[model samples]
Target: MSDMTAMELDEASGQAPRPLRERLSLGPFSDEWTAADWIVGSASVLLAIASAGFFGWSFVVSMKSPDYFQQAALANMPPKLDRIETGSIDVANAMPVPQIVRLSEPTPADYQIVMVFNNEALLATRNELMRVKVGSIVPGLGLVRTIDTEAGSPTVVAENATLHGAPATR
Candidate 1:
């Protein structure tokens, strides 16, 4: 075995010898990532989530209450009832209908009315008023409330704590 130190080997190879402490030095170039890097990365992630949440929430809220869709349905209604002369009803006059019901057959005094705005409704029969309730008609909207007996007598449950397409604020 040859007796030689690392310094001797380095010197023999015409290389500058490095001290043990200097060889073990931890400089910026040797670091994988700094505290500043972590802080900036975390901030970037937070900002992305915040921006997405802000826009996503806005879209969800708008979809929940689509006034334009409800308004369009009501606008197509006839100006008069059964050929009877009736003046033009304002948009406000037309009640928004989130749901509609059709009865099996038409009977005397058989009419449907809104019950609790989303749970049940009063269906007038010959003997008594029938309470008809159904599952959640609108997904986000809760249980049935309004009953449009003109069509199927199925009760409509909606969310928003009001009749589907109730009344416009303006």
Candidate 2:
């Protein structure tokens, strides 16, 4: 067995071990930075600081502005009034008179008018005697049945009808 160290083994393997400082160095070119590199780095840092300061100042100024938020909100919002008239003084001349178009003289309606009786409220009441069915007798008190010649047939179509027990006396 060869009595050689790790460094000797590395050397034997045609690879020289670098120093910790050199290995951890930032630049790949050289161990020491040039004057130009230092100047450029300092300038970059100074430029970054200056840019940050400018941005902060601008933000403070915008926040201090009275109509800043209002202007920003208005910029995002849709315009309320679309178009504005420039000159409008004469109301009589501007107003348009409606023209009635009469095609022919008004004729009597020929279509049969069907009457609809709504008994939804009476059906909703929870009284067995007061509740109306198909053939149930309805007391005529508040019930109103209107007969019109415009309505087609005089056929009685009764669903559930509301039955008032007593008449109101005032």
Top candidate, metric TM-score: 2
Report lDDT (CA) for all predictions.
0.55, 0.47
Give the worst 10-residue stretch by lDDT in candidate 2.
105-114
Tens digits of per-residue lDDT, candidate 1, 77-158, equal 8655742256556677677867534444433224334343344554444434555566434322345445443333433433
Worst 10 residues of 1 by lDDT: 161-170
Measured by lDDT, the strongest candidate is 1
Provide TM-scores for the models: 0.22, 0.24
- Write one digit per residue (lDDT tens) for candidate 2, span 1-170: 28986567667889887666665677776557787988998999999999999989878978789678678888999756533354435676666878644454221121121322342213222222233323533332223233222233232223322222222234
Q: Cα miss at 96, model 2 (Å)?
A: 73
Q: Which stretches of candidate 2 lie over 4 Å from their true place?
A: 1-16, 27-33, 66-170
